[model samples]
Target: MNKIADYIQTAKLESDKPFCAFLYDLDHLRAHVQARVDSMPANTRYFYAIKANSELPILRALAPIVHGFEVASIGEVRKVRSVSQDTPIIFGGPGKSDEELIGALEHNVSLIHVESMHELRRLNELCAKRDTVMPILLRVNLRGPLPTATLAMGGRPTQFGIDEMQIAEAIQLAKSLPHVKLEGFHLHSLSNNLNAAEHVKLVKYYIERIKGWAAEHDLELSYLNAGGGIGVNYADLEDQFDWDLFVGGLQPMLEANLPENMTVLFECGRYNTASCGYYAVEVLDIKENHGKTYAIIRGGTQHFRLPVSWQHNHPFVVVPSERWEYGFERKGVEDQQLTVVGQLCTPKDVLASDVTVPNLRIGDVILFLYAGAYGWSISHHDFLSHPHPDHIYLGGDDHV
Candidate 1:
């Protein structure tokens, strides 16, 4: 297992990762998974959510290891089908068309997560007409902080889930429909400050809620679906999440509350695959303004582009031929502020503001750190005039 430290060391020595590099530290990511899977009780399942980072290598790495795949669109559904036929498939996202629903049904996937009453009702009607029992998971509107915290994303008005007020009525509808099986409930809080421990807290909370609700409605609950917001901190490598501590914190709770025969399902998309991609591009020129210097790279927001996301700046690194003795400055000197801007026509094309690198030169390539998640896929403009950077998948048993 290559620790983050080992990856960094090897990268510094290899000398080949110069043009552009994302440096997917999946070795660390998989170590996190291995630690958790080892501790999790039987029947607990993890599903690699496809939206976060859907590169083929990332999918291939996760497919053989995870219990199933969770898809939000027919395109994602097709991606899963291309990989493994036996991999349990779960479909999600709102506004799925009738054709999409029909396709999902045709695939005989494990479950479909529905967001609205209209969708639920429509899916029920379709299942009845087809004379097939469609397995369904109810997405709840959990807002704010989840359990173990006062605020809630597992608690109201969350657009992704059905409103809390609608739960009982939906259940009644399910009981009478005779076609949709209410397998379990699902919740997803965006990437935030939670590790395996907080995730387990959510699971335990759901178990109690599901059990209590099952008793009230005289229903049998056989599944528990937990939302995926697994977070990966790329800026501070040492701040890497401790998956063992996380799994240790939740394993006992899950073992205690999970109903017998219930399959615990996890939807993890980003954290699972984000570490495996690398985006590389060469520097086109360098410009000097006042006392500051800037390196204009061939790729900008039009290519491997990511600026501030979720209100945080993305990680990036400038590759220098010689090892520098002085540390890289996080902020520029009072008179030396080199703002890196993308080549796009819009002013919003700025990539970083007031960033100081290794006194960048014309031919130096600036490598964006942890760019595997979006890189060329999210940044390229179909309408732009700039040439697109080529995407590559460096093969390794360990995710690329």
Candidate 2:
């Protein structure tokens, strides 16, 4: 049985207003993360990227399972600290204000990914002012024939990391800086890459490049941060990223090529938590417009914006509502193509585009899956100033 549907039904009985909510299964999230961690090879670590979902409950649930948290801002650093004061944090971002750098230093961040020469200089200065020495990974924008993914941060012109050609110069400068220590390289190239074989090949390429750099510079680095791009398949949930195959291919390559002392780091965000969440909204109206059917819900992109941002019809299930308090007949559509939209004023407030559904009604609930990661975190919550959806957690001690 669908537990989320039961909760939505109960909520509907308790209130007359149209409703929307983000429901997270904490037990599922914990188990999913644990499986990922357990499958990792020796000398490899998994870091949960906090930018995906920094909700306190999510962080608290993930803290015990992950090796550490990968944070991109001072606010994220503080969020992690609030949950686990001593949890290791790897701070990585292109634009870091002096205050944020200082905050990372004060919070005792385990490793900071330095993006540029100027940023490196600034960090060294800050450390010197505090009479402290900090460990860092020089984020490199690799020059390459790289694997194709949904989004590419490197292998092109971007404001993400230092260029590959400039890495030698950056290293020499880091050697001169008294308060900053260079530990390794951060090569986070792609986002939402689903092909497992291609991903393994990419990792192999990263290792070979890092090894060459280490030998040339005569350095013994502690880590090779291959920033995570393992993706979840929203188009077809059953055809997910092949973790077993990826691990099978990766463990052998790491054992053969990578140094025993160094650790390989993966900071995954979407794949870690996306499957454990569902966005539920009540359909308010069914209408026909220019030979097309549209079902308008109580929520909009303001609440959950992943589908619109990606321009893909997010996968969902319609939970039929049995109760009808209206004097008029309940209106619905059956065996027709439907476009699920939200209650926003703009025409772009669509969740799922023209897709065929068996049955849908005015009071039915639409529950969107794979919403635990970028769904809420990347949304413009105050766009139309609609009342926020209820954030409900299930099956965990921290449930509320």
Candidate 3:
């Protein structure tokens, strides 16, 4: 049997209950992460962005590979600590509570990326109470135009980081603070960028801009954090962000231009974990509506919301079923287009719209690809009181 058939057979044997199984190939995930880690320059560090896929198994598998983790919330910090206590971690976000800051200090996290002037002061105040100097990266929203990507977090006015225009003053203010040690800068702006060359340019741009700022201020920075926005091409499977080309371009640039003392850290989230996962939902009913075919599955956008959020058609494969008990023909539409929807009553609960599929049937399964990263966590699970999907890890003797 093929991979799709194998997954469907496994699902059938594991549970008679209705579920959407999120299958992960840990071996693939390990190799993918290791390849990136191996390709990084000597001065560059690789940190897995936990926001991508924080599942315990995923984190556990990556603990032995990645240099450390980049987390946005205190919960994430706690989660990482639970998995591996010794690994380095960097905490960053737009809004962090005083308790969270204190927790980070108590735990002695590797670094914290200060998002704003107020947050800088807040962190300083919290650090003063502990009588400890906290290392920080001034998260800068660059002054120039944002990089071309599906989502831009910086460049324009947003809640992410301190604007580039005010960095000098922020640095000056940090100098006065006794408890906060200003180390470097963190620039993370774009997401889902398909162009590998453009991402390389963005990383170089960050380095040069930070070098200029450091020269003007007469500061000795320790690291320039090229925050993770490295993207995956969901639209075209064949067209991807060429990792080998990206690493090839980065190696020469860093060797020639990067300051010897300053190390660069890359916090990759989506790009690292996106490809190792697959979401499989069984087709419950197939019908024609308004001259269009719709395959209503046991789950919907509440479970897997990436398609709706991106407003793009998600790619899926049809797993054919041989057991048809009814005295009638199998309900299917071959070579034609159909919309895949969930069990929810709302019209917004669509997973794919007008996508091409071959020989789809009611008893068959629809395996959604490229669902490893944002599929599990980003969805609104409580929209309806449906049972959660069963998260199944595909590889490893202990997990399968």
Candidate 4:
């Protein structure tokens, strides 16, 4: 049996309540991230976005491999610092408070992605107060004929970054500010972009645009922050982001159009960590309601909210368990389509919908795949005050 199945079986033997836990394969994570880092072209860097999974074990595993970390809040910055104090950190988010800005500055963050004109000024003012000159990347909301992505933070009216048309003005402001140094532009417009060719095309577009802007403004820039949106195929695990294809296309583009001494940075969250994590919950009950069958699990959206949040049937496997402690007829459904739900009162507590499962019993564990990123970290854990699932890490230097 695979590690997930093996772990589930072991947990069933140990626990009588229900097996609900997040199992992270550190060996798999390290191998996957190392492959991605090794495959990147010259002058290219990969920064793991901590918003995906901020667990300490995950951070420690990735610290040596990734070039740096991309954080959204001060809390994330502190988390990275606790793991590796010397690792470079780039802060980026909307509605950043004064304390967050101060924290970023005091913590010696390598870069801060300025979202707006007011934010730029605010950061500049904060830097002046500290008597420190800070390097900043002006995040631009490009006006583009861009490719379709799962989520768009730019190329539209969103509370993300400065408008492309107003970028020139923002650059001028940054230059005039005494305490802030303009590094480059951050064009992280898309989220969950699956097409490798289209992503390479987007990178080319970013390079050309930035080159034009540098010439026009006479701006000496070093970093080009291309936000990470490489997507995961939740529907089909077999179909995934072609990293080799992307690198094949990207290497030539960077070598041809990239400016001299410019280091292109990719801050990827989901793509790096999603595959190495699994959310396994034991089945509490199995029954047919009206015409459809419902296999209720011990956990729900509160534990793993990716399916309901994305409105897609997350991929999973039913780990069969032989142990049945109840003194009654064992409930099960064989070769039938079922909707997996959690033990929540609301109807929205769904994990997988309209999925066909063969031989799913009441005691069997449902292991949801591709759950490393944005699973437990983004969930409402306090909802209904249910007991939180145990976090189990497997096969790493530090296995806790």
Candidate 5:
């Protein structure tokens, strides 16, 4: 009956399984987003980038509160479409086809973040046939290397936007076409900014550039979108956020240069919606081998897709119950180093390489921390044929 050997001695347990819950701190995410929205000087708007985590329940929770959505594909556009129509959805990507453009415009989407002249002509043909003007914000490549070497090297030389040198030409083209409005200027740098200073630098660059573009062209800037690259707190740093400073970093530039009545839009994904989620998993087996104990969890990289992409570094922790120690005792004897691994075919399928844990018997619950941003569906894929993880919205019911 020693506490160290009992399985789970707690009373308020939801299930007798090791859970894979991605704890969503949505309020915090919303607060972070709203703070950015409210602190802006003038015409500024925000579009929650939905690719980070497209959990339905998570999107359901956020859709009503957000100003708009930034979708990269037709599927994502459809996702937002099913929820709300009033919330403007802007579709942005480099390889969109005529069908996708038609779908977006069919829904009366707020904006099309256009990448090329061919697409502009296509939109003109599509809209002229439909007798409508498609508002667009040209994505310009402003990714001129960040301060960090690793992150700078992490980004590929991509032409996702209308390159900066083509700005004036793009504007002239937009006006001459008669079917598209050059509504705003959009520039999203790569997401590897190690700090906020570079992001601020980007915002300042946009403000100055947009100001000059608008003044020279008499375009009357309506929207100035500062693209999203807000880093998350997956690093486990004690002070994960520098909120006041982050908000302050771009606020001054926005306050100084935004055009009259223009809404500044932000396409934040991980920053606005990632932290407010939890991934629950059940422990399948525990064994000691070669001086290293392993906690093999049931799910694989197919369920949590980031491991396959090598864009993952999430933290894992046990849900703290009043009788957590007793729960561990019921499982086994002494605490040990538990290297958590997935039921994946590849030898590299590791959730966490090394973790200290109270001796866990089969079926003890494990909670992964900071998994809110990009956990399950974004984890890994190929061969498992597993269904995507079920989203369990807290303050609610059993999703499975």
Candidate 6:
């Protein structure tokens, strides 16, 4: 199959609009997800986190492969349900309204991860009103010396989960609640932790802690939801998480140590989808300022904002172009650092800075790879009234 970026570049050449688009390769997505699924050991399940890329076609393409989905809001619940009827759904977030709780109960979601004692009580009351039992996993803010990560939430006091000091109290409260069943704990501590061994170690810590709690409370937990923070190498495009090494380390450890009755679930978002998407934008102008080359593109952070959020030089390739119409000498620089900026008026709209690339000119396309996950969804599309780039789907004949 053609590289996703190359395919997108061909499509961009055929289009008349300002050359920019978010292209998703369904074939690549399917293969990537399937490989991850296949690598996982038995008793472990995979759930696609819909917050990564909630596009209808992306959801539909992934529904059949994943066991279920992890949604943060009621709208996501509905969206997942629209694509899948039988697949299980798990709801988790810092804040959830009474209406959302009721809706989740009505939909019979597989599990609602309780973020705090208050949320636990709220869910209990909501379940009581419906006269139905609600299954839940306590989202714990593990007070820890966790593995170093790009973003760490578990070891600190964050809005994500219950404090580690209160687990015993939370367990007693769970016992008192009649409608809510605390089946296990959700330990989602880090974001983008790349080390496979470190991830395995984190999971081991979660199991030991949860097992100790279950034994102390004399409770038989069903599952431990390790909130997914699987990393993607955004800084180096060729580098990726060593899934083989991860699985190799994880399986043996689980086989020897993990409790036989408990199952593990990984609700991965970015790692599952990032590799399949590409964002391509055409250079509208090229100029030199203060000994620095700047290539301004038609679109900026409004359409692709992950680079700015991560503050990394997002990897890209220069789709070299020879199309030049100007009678005057064209501006071109070779083997020099190029700072890529979007059309947004603000200076903070830079996508990449001080990156060495081939000479660039007006009409040359810069295709940003690995933009499938948080590229468009987290962007400020309406910030400056810039036209949204076409969201094109590759691998299938459909164009959006």
Q: lDDT: which candidate is best?
A: 2
Better of 4 and 5 by lDDT: 4
Query: Model 4 over residues 168-266: C-alpha lDDT tens digits?
Result: 899899999999999998999999999999999999999988999999999999999999999999988999999999999999989898999999999
Error of 6 at 342 (Å): 0.5
Residues 1-400, candidate 1: write the lDDT tens digits.
1233344344545554334334455554566445555566677788877777665656776676777889888888888888787789999887888888888998778899888888888988888889998989887765434644222454644457677667888778877777888988775644544466666676676777778778888987778787666666765746765666767766677677778888777787656655555444445555667765655556567665546343334555555433322464322223345766656667566566666554554434455655656555565555467655544444445432
Candidate 3 lDDT over residue span 1-400, tens digit each? 1554586766666665544778888888999999999988888999999998999999999999999999998999999999988899999988999989998987769999999999999999988887899999999988766578888888887888998889999999988999999899999887777777878888889989989988998888998998888888888877888889888899998888888799999999999988888888888899998899899998888888899999988888876655556798777778888899999889888888888886887878788888888887899887779877878776754343
Kindly report which residue stretches of model 2 are placed more than 4 angstroms away from their true locations once superposed.
397-400
Residue 392 displacement in candidate 2 (angstroms): 0.4
Give lDDT tens digits, candidate 2, residues 1-400.
2787888888888898886899998889999999999999988999999898999999999999999999999999999999999999999999999999999999999999999999999999999999999999999999988998888999999999999999999999998999999999999999999999989899899999989998898988999999999998999999999999999999998999888699999999999999999999999999999989999998989999999999999999988888789999999988899899987889999999889989899999998999998988899999878988888888865544
Candidates 1 and 5, the one with greater lDDT: 5
Give the TM-scores of the predictions, in the order they appear: 0.83, 0.98, 0.96, 0.98, 0.84, 0.97
Q: Model 6, which residues run further than 4 Å from truth?
A: 1-6, 325-329
Ranking by lDDT: 2, 4, 6, 3, 5, 1
Candidate 6 lDDT trough over 10 residues, lowest sum: 1-10
By TM-score, how accurate is candidate 1?
0.83
Q: Which run of 10 residues does model 3 get worst, by summed lDDT?
A: 391-400
For candidate 5, write residues 1-400 as lDDT tens digits: 1121122234226454444444455555556566766765445566788888776666766776677889888998888878776678888988899889999888878999888778888998999988989999887775454444223211246758776677788888888998888888777756635467666776777777788888888887678777777676565535454656766766676677656677778887776665555555667677778988777876756676554455444565553333243334444424676677777777777767666675555665565655666666565445576444545554333254
For candidate 6, what is the lDDT? 0.87
Model 5 weakest lDDT span, ten residues long = 1-10
User: Residue 340 of candidate 4: its Cα lDDT?
Assistant: 91
For candidate 3, give the lDDT: 0.86
